[model samples]
Target: MHPVLFEVIGLPISPYGLLIALGMLTGIWVAKRRGRAIGIPEEAVYDTVFWGVLLGFVGARIAFVLVNFGAFLRDPLPLVFSREGFVFLGGFLAALPVIAVVLRRWRVRYLAMADLLAPSLALAHAFGRMGCFFAGCCYGGVCDRPWAVRFPRIIDWRRGPVDLAEAEFTPGGAIYHGVDRVGDVVGSPAFYDQVKHGQLDWSDTASLAVHPVQLYDVAIQLGLFALLSWMWWRRRTLHGQIFLLYLWLYAASRIVLELFRGDLERGLWFGGWVSTSQLISGGLIVVALGLTLQRRRLFAPASEPAAAPRDPGDA
Candidate 1:
């Protein structure tokens, strides 16, 4: 996987960051177009998209760092200032209340607005999954299938069993000078000819073959977007149902997809039996189910008033 897509002068353009930004822009554009079509004010769309994205990005970063607190504690600046490790669940959950507040303040129907935004969110997420593919985070468990991809830069030995001395002496493993098994090279060459040949790269990284979960995520999210869009088109008379359906479908999808995830930072409960996203998805599914049923009942045709009782004598 290519972490750094390229460099402009001295500045690096990360595919992860670039793609996330592009996805946000696309989502915003969709919201604006749909809001206008629904007769919503342009200002409302702008306010919601702008603030929601900003806050959501912050929330995503904060959630990721908090979940992986121990690692960040050692050297906090890299994670704090860098544009990686943004958790989608954190962003989605955080954006909901903010968007709700914005809509409520504007006196707009929150459910209708949510419906308009649902497909956009899915579309953006599809792109974000592509970003993850390039950046190599959110990787899946190792697999030997034909579709299983090998990320040459993402080695499997970062915190795994490592003998530094072996890395130094193993020809093309990694070179170290004045460090032992733990980077205490006694008298190894500072730079080997292979280093110039690009044999060794960013030291901590390792290469391993893993499932291409990113592609799987993209496929599912795009499919969800299409489904939501179609539902919105067909059920224009229905308010909130489309969004609820989206939540239910997306939550179900996330639960299944988390099973393939190999990243350790995503919280795992019950000794790794249930993932954090899976738990959230389960909760969302229950909530959406209840809301869907309730909303449908509220919108359903009322039962005909019971016929006026007639006195048996009169009959």
Candidate 2:
């Protein structure tokens, strides 16, 4: 809920963008602090996170647009610049090589560096899913369950994604105030007092009470973050195992969670029986398992007993 946190000098700074920025900042800060403990310089951590995040953000947005090309093709300018839609997998994978190069250039152990940053990445991603909850993009299927929640005015029957054809925007080219907010820009908070909340009266035209998969995503991702943090504290996992475990656990959870997802813009295949993320997750699971088998050691003292000369899959 609460997509638009508040207007900043008449420009709406969406909760989506704000939470993403916060996730990036907090994630980098935590990674940097952790980096210092392991002999990585603060400046190096800063640079690594900066370039990785920059590339990740751009890649995620581009991946979203690429998957939903039809929508972007009609009138792509607004969505192209807007900091709304993103694909986590795209962002995560996109940054892997960049971070690897950064670690190599900075003379840091690549696998260990990935292990150090894994927890921070999970934590940041958990927050980003919460941002999706606020924005109501990655919504879930309709349900009659007691906890099912509604997102009000998530779509306007009269108007499609954006009425670029009509061209009813402000003098400065911003979206008008009273237009039927469409596409991802719609969606009001789930909880609203009928008698007290006037601005939230979009319930009259709201989307049906659904599974609230976004909130479900938040819970699962937080669990993923916790698992990574716990594994890190244990310090018994293999040098690259932490990141591999992240991939495994995340893939496992996502495979299940994607079943409850409702928004259809995300790429799908096999007659909608499988989402793109599910396919990738399935592939990553095998990758994680293979790495685990190859390592044959988890609690080894010297990081990796015998690391591959150059394993890009370490991440």
Candidate number of the best TM-score: 2
Measured on C-alpha atoms, candidate 2 has an lDDT of: 0.68
Q: Which segments of model 1 are wrong by more than 4 Å?
A: 154-206, 297-315
Q: For candidate 1, what is the TM-score?
A: 0.77
lDDT per residue (tens digit) for residues 211-303 in model 1: 789899999999998988887767655667677888988999899988887665567789989987888889998988788778866432212
Clashes of 1: 10
Tens-digit lDDT track of model 2 for 78-101? 457755778888887788899887
The lDDT for every candidate, in the order shown, is: 0.68, 0.68
Clashes of each: 10, 2
